[model samples]
Target: MKYIFFVLCWWLAGTLSAQQLKGRVLEAGKDGNVGLPGANVYWLGIPGGVATDVDGNFAIEKRPNGRLIISFVGYASDTLEIGEKDHYIEVVLKAGHQLDEAKVFKRGQTTIMNTKSPVIEQVITGEELCKAACCNLGESFTTNASVDVSYADAVTGAKQIQLLGLNGKYVQMMTENMPNFRGVSVLYGLNYVPGPWMSAISVSKGVGSVTNGYEAIAGQISVDYKKPQGSEKFYVNLYGSDEEMFEFNMNGSIHLNDKWSTALLVHGDWMEKEHSMHHNGFLDMPKKAQYNLMNRWAYKTDAWFVQFGGKFLDENRLGGQKGFREEMRHQIGEGNLYGISINTRRYEGFLKVGYLMPQYENTSMALLVNYTDHDQESYYGGYEYDARQRSLFMNYIYQSIFGNNPNQKFSAGASFNYDNYDEIFGDYKRTENGLVKNTPVNPQREERVGGVFFQYTGTFWTKLTLMAGLRYDYHNLAGGFVTPRFHIAYMPDEMTTLKFSGGKGRRYAAVLAENAYLLASGRSVNVAGQLLSGRPGALKNLDMEEAWNFGVLLNRKFLLFDRLLNINLDYYRTDFSHQVVADNETRPGMINFYNLDGDSYSNCYQVEIRYELIPRFDIMGAYRYNDARITYSAPEGLRRVRTPLQSRYKGLINLSYYTNMKKWQFDFTTQFNGPGRLPGGNQQFESFQLMNAQVTKFFRKWSIYAGCENIGDFTQKHPIIAADAPWSVDFDASRIWGPIHGRKFYVGLRFGFDRD
Candidate 1:
C-alpha cells in the first residue's frame, strides 16, 4: 500500500511540529471524585514535562507558554504565568509519610543497574567520609567495617555502636528517617550527632523491611543532612586532641526569594580533659562541655508543601575524685570518693500535608506530624537522678501503580505513637561496721506508652521485590508485643544477586542507665520481681523483657579489571525467652535481672570488602564476630556469663584519596580487637586489645587533622583494687573490660557549612 503511505507521512510530520495542552490532575477544594499521582508537569524553558499518570489525567504535546512548572515530594512546587489562550491545570501534593529517603542513583562501578529495592543497598559519600577526618559522631567511620564503636564500661566516658557483631542496642539510629536515636538516647547520643552535619550516612545490616519498624533487629543507621536543595556554599570546623579535647563546628544556608528556603547549624565542645585516674583511687573521665543548635525551613507552591526544624542541647559531665569535692561524701571519711554529674535538655518539631485526587491517573494522598521534649538531671555518690520526657508522631499515605506496566507499584500506610515518662532512683546506706547512712534508698517511677502500625510495599518481576510489615505494641509494663516483617530481593543476572532479611524487635532495661556499675557498687537490686515495685525479689516473678530475633543475608557484586567490586556477608540469630541478663556472681552485694535458664542466645557475624581502586582511590575491609552468652537457672545450674564491650574478634582497614580540584585530601585508618570474656577473675591482665592509626589532609573553608591514638597504647593492666578483695565484702567495681587508659597523642580541626 505504498509502504503504508510513507508511514502516515512521517507521523503527520511529527504532529505538525507539536502543540496541544490539556489537564485535570485535581485535588484542591474537591467536589466529586479526584486523583493525584507523582504530580509534575512542565514548560519552564520548554522540553516536554509529564509526571502524573495513575489516572489524574494529563496531555500536552508541548505548547503552553509563560513558564509553567509543577513539583512533588511532600508537595509545594508550582508556577504558571500569563497564558495567551488554551489552559487548564491543578496540583496539590503533600504527605510526608513519617519516613522514606531511598533515592540515590548515580550508578558507576561495573554498571548493571535497575532498582526496585529489596535491600542490599550501599552509599557512603561526602566523598566517602573525606578520609575520616571525622572528628564528631563518635570517631567518624573509624575505617567503617559497617560501623563499630565500643567502650562503655571502665567508668562513663560512654561510646557504643556495633553492627553485625550485634548489640549496639540492635541498631536503628535515624535522623532524617527520624526516630532519631532511641530510649534514653542511647547514652550520649553519639556525642550529640555532629560530624559537620553529615551529608550522607546510610548503612543497613539486617531485618528492616516491615515499613521500617517493628524495630530493626541488628541494623539501620540513616542520616542525611545538607538540604535547602543540596547545600555546600560555606562551612567551618576546628578541633584539638591529646587528651585535652577542644572543638567548634558551624554551617549556613540561604535563599529566600523564589518560594523561600533557609538553614543554620552551630556546634561547640570544650574538654578540660585529663583521662587516667584509673579508678583504683577513683577518677577515670569527667570534665566536659558540649552544645548544639539547629534550624531549617522550606516552602513551595503549585499545590502546596512545607518543612520545619529546631534543636538545642547542652551537656556537662564530671567523673570522680581526681581531687574530690562533691561537698565531701560524709565528712568523717573525708577522702570522699566517686563523682558523676549531667544535665541535658531537648526540643523538636516536624510537619507534612498533601491532598490531590480526581480518579486515578497519578493519584495522591499524604500526612505526617511530629513533636518531642526531653530533659535530664544526674549525679552519683550522694545519689540523685531525674528524667522527664514527652513525645508524639503520626503518618498516613497512599501512592499508585497506574495501569498494567509502568511497572506496577503500590504503597499503603498508617502509624501513631506517644510517650510520657518521669523518673528518679537514689541510693546510699551502710552500717554493720562501716557506718555511712542518711536514710536513703529510693525509687519513684511513672510511664505511659502507645503504638500502632501497618505497612505494605510491592513490585513484581522487573527482577523481584517484596516488603511486608506489621506492628502492634502496648506497654504499661511490657504487656503486649507483636511485630512481623519480611524483605526480599532477587536479581540473578546483571552479574549475580539473592538476598533475604527477617525481623522482630523490642527493648527496655534502664534499671539505672543499664546498671550504673550496679548502683555504683552499692549493689542489692533484683528484678523479674514482676518489673519491680519492691519485694522478696532476686528476680521474683518478672515479665516485660521479651525478645525474638531472626535474620539472614548475603550480598555479592563483581568486576575484575573494569573496576568496582564488593562482597558482603551477614548472619544473625537472637532468641531470648524474656531477658535482662545481669548478675553479680552469686551473693557479694547482689545484682540480678531474671527470665532464663541453661540457655539464651545471640550469635552474630560479618564480612565485608569494597574497592574503587581507580577513581580517586579507595580501599576497604571488615571482619566481625560475636557469640555472647548468659544462661543460668535453678539451684545454680548453667552459669554462662560474658557480654560487655564485646570483642571476640573485629578487624578493619580503610583508606581514601580525593580530587576534582575540590582541595587536597588523603586518609588512613586501622582497628583490631580480639578476645572476649572478662569479668572478675583476672590473674593480672593481658587478654588482647590493640588499636592503631594515622591521618593526613586538606580541606576548604575549614580542615586540619593530626593523629596518633593509642598508637599501641593498649591497656587493662591491674584492673583496679581487686588485689584479692582488699576492702573486704569482695570489692567490686563492675568487672570492667579492657582499656583502662594508655597511649595518647592527638590533634584535630574541622569546619562545616551546607544546606543551600
Candidate 2:
C-alpha cells in the first residue's frame, strides 16, 4: 500500500542520517565557560559544514567518519582526528576572541550587539526565524513576549500587535527603523511583511532616540530586511490554516556580478470560504485577497555603505450577512441588513548612505530619505470612506569619541518629517419602515504635520550611561507640541543592570484606526468640531489625543547548574492630557467623539525568564499585567471606562529533548492566559482563560511541528453583545474579549538550503 511505501521512505532517510561525532566548542578563558560563537567548525575537506552560534552550539551532519578542521577569522587553524568511538570532544580556541562572535561596526548604522546606546536593545536574528516555519514577520512574535499579537475585529481577518500594553499604532512600526505604517497599511500591514526575507527585528523599549521622532509611546519595533550583498538564495513557502486560508511566501536574491546584488520578497494570501460556518446570519469571515512586494539592494565597501529599497502592497476584503453576494452588494435581514467591502494600496521607498571616517576608530556619518504614498477605498453598508496619505521622512546618525578609548563612544542625530492627509466619510441615511431615504451628511478632512528632533548619548564612571533626547512638532492643524526623553543605566556588576527612563510624548490620535471594531456595525462618526481645517464639509471640531509615558526596568543573568539563566522585568505608566473617547450609550446610530474632560491613563508590568536545565533541555516563562482606562465628557459631564477586555496574567513554558543516542529531537511548548474585564454592549461578555501547546520533531533533513490552539476550547458562554437589533441601529462589535474560536489543530513541515 502507499502508506507502507511512505513509511519505508521515512525510515530509510532516518537510518541513513550521519552517525553522531559530537564535539563541544569552547572559548579559551579563565573560567572555562563561554562558547565561541561563529567559529568555523567543520569536518576536514568535507563537502559541507557550519559555524557555531554565539553560544558555541552547533550540530553538523553528513560528515564522513574522520578528522575535522577548526578555523576562524584572526585565529590559528587546528585539525583534530576523529574515530568511530570519538562521538564527542571538546575544543578550546586561542584567546583571539575575534573568532568568537566579534561584531562589525563602521559608523552611523550598526547592529545592536555593537551599539553604544545607553538604552537596552534586543535583536531577533534571521537564524532564529529559520528555526520555525511562519508566514509573516509579524507572526515571528510567537517566541517573543515584548510584542503581543491580537485579532483585528473578528470579521475583518486582520491582526494588530501590542507592546508595553499599548496598541500597535502607539508602538511605531518601521522598515529598518524608517517610518512606514499609516493609512490603509495600518489595517493589514502585518500581513505585508513575509517572514523569510527578514534579517533581524530589533526591539527598543522605553525611550529611544529623538531622531526617530517620538511616535513610540511604549517602544519601537524596527524591521530589517536581508541586505542584498550577503544573502542566501531563493525561498518558497506554502502555509494553510484550518480556517481554509492559504498563504504563499517567496524571496529571491541575485548577484549581478561583483558590484551589484538585488533581492525581491513577495507575499500572497487568499481565502475561498465566505461563511464562518457558525452561520449566526453573519459572515464568519470575508472573501479576501492580499499581495505585497519589496525590492531592496545594498552596496558596501571599506569606506562607504549605500542601501535602497522600495515596497508595495494591495489588498481587498468583502463581508456581510452569510448569504450576501458581492454582485448584489445589498441584503436585508428579518431585523436589518448590512454589507461591507474594502480595498487598499500602499507604496514606500527609502535610501540610506553611510561614510566612515578614517580618522576615528568608530566614527561615521549617514544620510537617509524615506517617502510613502498610501490610499484606501471602502464601503460599509454602502457608506463609502475614501482616504489618501503622503509623507516624507529624513534622519542622520553620526558617531565618534572625544577620547582614545573605543568604549567611550558618543552618538548624535537629527530628523525631519512631513505628512499630508485627506479623508472623506461618505453621506448616509436610514430606513425605519422598510423604506429608504437620503439624508445628506458629507464629512471630509485634510491635515499636514512637520517635525524636527535632536538626540545624544554618553557613558561615564565605567558603570553608568545616560541618553537624553528632545523633539518639536509644528502642525498645520493642532498648533505645536514637544517631546523630551531621558534614560539612565547603572551596572553594579557585569551580570546585573538597573535601567530607568522618563519621557514626555504626544501623538495626534486617529481614533478609527486605533479601534476600528467600534464601526464594524456601520455606525457613522459624529464629531463636535473640525478634526482638521481647510476642507469643504469637513468635521468642524476635533482635537489631538496626547499623553506622557515613563518606565523603569531591570535585568539579571547568572550561571545555574553550569548553564545560562536570564531574568527581565519592567514597569511603565502613561498619563493622558487629552484622549478621544467613543460615547455609544447616547446614540446607537452614531458615537460621540471629544477630547478628555477629566483624567485618563494606563499602567503595564511584565516579567520573563529563560534557563538551560541540562544538555538539550531548556525552560522559559513570561507574565504581563495591564491597567488602562479613559475619561470623557458624558451626559453626566464626565465618565470613566475601563479598557475593553484583556488578560491580566499570562504564562508560558517550553521544553526540548535531544541526545547523541538517536538522530531525533522533540520540542514542546505551552502558553496560559488568565481572565480580565469585559465590556457590555446590551450585555457584557464573561472573562475566560486560554491554554495552548505545540510539539515539534526533528529528523534528518526535515522538521515537523503540530499544535492545538485553545486547547481547553474555553469561550464565553453568552454572545459578546446583547440587544442585537437586526432591524434597528443598536449593534456593537467592539465589546469583544477572550478567545471566540474553539480548539483547533495544525501541523507544518520545513526544509532549507544555502549555497556558498
Highest lDDT: give the candidate number: 2
* Candidate 1 root-mean-square deviation in Å: 24.8
Cα lDDT, model 2, residue 400: 77
Cα displacement (angstroms), candidate 1, residue 585, comes to 5.7
Compose the digit string of candidate 1's lDDT tens values, residues 191-273: 88788788767676666644445556666777777765346546776767667777787777777755677778788888775
Report the error of model 2 at residue 50, Å: 19
Model 2: per-residue Cα lDDT over 380-463, one tens digit each: 654556667777888887877767866455556666677666666543345455524234334444455566665556677767
TM-scores for candidates 1 onward, in order: 0.29, 0.80
In model 2, the clashing pairs are 335-726, 335-727, 336-726, 529-540, 529-541, 530-539, 530-540, 530-541, 530-542
Q: Which lDDT values do the candidates have, in the order given?
A: 0.58, 0.63
TM-score of 2: 0.80
Q: Predicted candidate 2: what Cα RMSD to the true structure?
A: 11.4
Residue-pair clashes per candidate: 38, 9
Question: In terms of TM-score, which candidate is strongest?
Answer: 2
